[model samples]
Target chain A: MNLFSIFGLGGNSHGVRKTESSGKEEHFTDTYILALVHKLRTPLNAARWALDSVIHGDDTGKEAQREILNEGYNKIISAINTVNEILKAAEMDSKDGVDLKKEKLNLCDIVDDILKTLGYLIKRNEIKLEYGDKCNPTIIFGDREMLDLSLTNLFDNAFRYSPKGNVFVALTREGGMAKLVIKDDGIGIDKEDMSHLYEKFHRGKNAKVVDPNENGVGLYATKKIIEMHGGKIEVDSELNKGTTVEVDLPID
Target chain B: MADFTNKRILLVEDDNFLSELLSKKLMESKANVMRAADGEEAITMVKANPKFDLILLDLMLPKVGGFEVMEAINADPKIAGTPIIILSNLGQKNDVEKGVSLGAKKFLVKAILSLDEIVDAVAEIIK
Candidate 1:
């Protein structure tokens, strides 16, 4: 899906150009609508980031502060759960239901956003995650919502499988592309497991043993979204050593 | 050396929640903050005041949009050079690039940005 067309950009994405058709006004409305969708989702993630930081023991000095933070943490979970339920219900109506409104975004910022949202989960699992560098930059053109879901599921998989070891994430800008490598020293996937790992509802033989609640569908979802953005996911693993899933996306 | 303690900033926004949050954060950084709730007021403030070090703007507003405000302010030669940072939830790629071409120093998406991150960006911009 060329979002430049949807937003009436006439093909050029990095710079502005007038639309060939007489629908300039219509394009403006569509741009505003796309922006409106983003605005609707801003606070949900922002609140989660702020609350997760506090709940993950940024400060536990005062009783009231702890109480309020805990309440906020729980509330964000309920809100997220409700939103997920709604999205899942929507998904049932259409296989590819989630709207993919493409846009150019910083790869690092998206990763950091998801990490903040999962701050509490990471803290609970005792996973040491790293990805930001002041000097390095990684920017990509893709749908923020779809990419958010893809990266969330990817990080979720990495965190759940690896309980003791660090789950390191790094964004490498090289060869005119950005590579997000999520490597974990968890129960590594068997070679056979890699065969159907990206198939819907297919999980490794040992995945259930580590986390019974594993949906077995997250990787497939992540792969689909990544593919939609003209990216590829490759998994390298040893049965006992670790697993690394590298997502390479073209940079704009 | 851009010390925010003595620098004035114009924060143009309509959302009270975000306005208060960002305003409070910028103030804590010791920046003297002025505010405009709409693009019309922002234009006036940008034109009337020449001492502002930076202008933080939001797109959606009650009276006018941020782009118009940008155009109105940038049209004036005296304040045209003042860097304007777009702190918005308008996360579309086109929106960001458009803002940049219109003379935005940086386009920071609010949804994926923490207040601390934004404050850091402001500090960097001031420097």
Candidate 2:
């Protein structure tokens, strides 16, 4: 974070001068790129490690090899998604941003699809998963696929972080806006992590210390999608307690 | 002959497939493994069952992440002295340093390390 050039401390101080604003912008983008690199490498590492394990284990059986192949495929897909997210985040810096295919989409339908996809894990983990009555067929105006992905990331984090705890999700129409409240009674996040939570490649300290597939890009991309929909996301968390994320998107 | 006949071990991980693989391998070694899918579960299990010979901790978990789990384990007077080996995919110096600082005995990255390497480390430490 120390950009000596910003203050013209060590860059041609005698004759030429560096514009403070330009230097600051450069420093900001530098940090952003560093984080983006980290995000890209995470999925790459997963794919590489999976491939390496497959090779190292020497499992010759058809079933064993097939399982490894499946793992690799998932890892690779994850990597591709990460790349697309990074590209999308970069595109957001432009005035055009996201050209979302806005449509009438049911919030319940999207949530249910994601839940059904991950139902096995939810059941196996003994989690008390709930999508309350408030979530009953709430309609929203937004890009269906984009909202689906954004909500998926939100739910994914909620479930991944909670260890045999409750995941409560509710979609309600407020006075003027639609609200999505997702609360998890798992491990909470650190206060320091909140500021950078939406940054392109910022993972909380505690989040990085665990053995789950967490790419920092998920939150970033989620934030981007929300912003494109003219929505807001807020997080409330306490260490060792739990986290509640509330996303407010516009409605018809 | 089983390498760890009746030895009790606690495995902390979030990835289901990886956890299953390790659990199966540990069972083959004759070690009784109790798994915790997240950091909170690991801390709770260690406190509730202090008799476990070893705690295999994973850093990236769902609810309670790994460092907090280690700190919680040490915070509990009853299980304060439980032996914990850090296991996670976060292969960075800061992560390893933080885990060690939280009283974890050793750090093992899941991505680079093989099952045999981890198993051997566990055997050596427990023996």
Candidate 3:
């Protein structure tokens, strides 16, 4: 009946679910659930404070009140997006795999849309984004929504990790494949953390030190989505130096 | 209601909406408010103007972090004595202890406190 029961975190005997029989896996599940709660609280807190200001503050005019309301609305939308991502990741983890609606899509358009969504944070963090494309309208055959989610995950990491640094995103063609490169001169991964980069709920030590609220599900879901599309993902990183991620997909 | 006429306060928070709301509230109390969007910027501003009446710091930041910023300030004799009130989402016992040990006069969790309460805390501190 409670929220934790819905996630099988409650103490109810029937709520208990079986895992891979590894203590590490169970630990990961617990950590992931906690992180999800923390992540959800962030946007909700913002929305709450916005509403609080509108209700209590007296000096604000109608214009300012409207702006605060809009901010609260956006924060609620952000919380919904986080929940949707959790659902998408869970669906992808299912044995049947995620259902994808295949279509002809342009990688450039997808990249542009994600960038537009992140433009505010990019500017606030003082990150300079350099987007280059050797092949215009690099087309690929895939599910637009799934690819959008995957690429957005990658792009989000690139921008989020890089503060006051440059993010260079390049797109090119390599024979029968389309290559997308996202490089950031931000806090990079350590050697030990590199091996488990794609593991569910595994966050790099340095990454956690920088942003502690990260849930560590983005890369795991991203890899799954990419693999389902018959694509490949590669990452190269050096601690404090930077990170570069290369994703290759079959060209249309 | 507390008045903070000409009292200078530096608010170190990254969230645009939250920062704007807090800043507006502090300004309504007549406190002169300076804002920092990241830990690095917070440190820079603190060093540049060490005469601030109080500081409101957020732990999770972009380039640097809140605790590190406090450390940097504590290292410098000129800014070491500046009063700081940590306003963060991290409210674990260890986090609060660390903030207190780092010379934070008060540790306030953002989620639990209302704007009026935060302003009141600030006013009480600097009064």
Off by over 4 Å in 2: A1-61, A118-125, A132-135, A210-213, B1-127
How well does candidate 1 reproduce the true complex, by DockQ?
0.08
Residues B1-127, candidate 1: write the lDDT tens digits. Answer: 2248988999987644456556766776688999987777888888888648889998765456788888877788888878889987675787888898899989987767776777778888887
Worst 10 residues of 1 chain A by lDDT: A6-15
Each model's TM-score, in the order given? 0.45, 0.59, 0.79
The CAPRI classification for model 3 reads as acceptable
- What is each predicted model's overall lDDT from 0 to 1? 0.70, 0.72, 0.83
Better of 1 and 3 by lDDT: 3
Which interface RMSD values do the candidates have, in the order shown? Answer: 15.4, 5.1, 2.2
Which candidate do you rate higher for DockQ, 1 or 2?
2
Candidate 3, residue A228: Cα displacement in angstroms equals 1.2
The CAPRI-style docking tier of model 2 reads incorrect
Superposed Cα deviation of residue B95, candidate 1 (Å): 54
lDDT of 1 at A224: 69
Give residue B22's error in model 3 in angstroms: 0.6
Q: Which prediction has more favorable lDDT, 1 or 2?
A: 2
Which scores greater on TM-score, model 2 or model 3?
Answer: 3
Q: First chain of model 1: TM-score?
A: 0.64
lDDT of 2 at A237: 92
Best candidate, TM-score: 3
User: In candidate 1, what are the lDDT values of residues A5-58, reduced to their tens digit?
Assistant: 333234432223446674884575464445335534554544644464454423
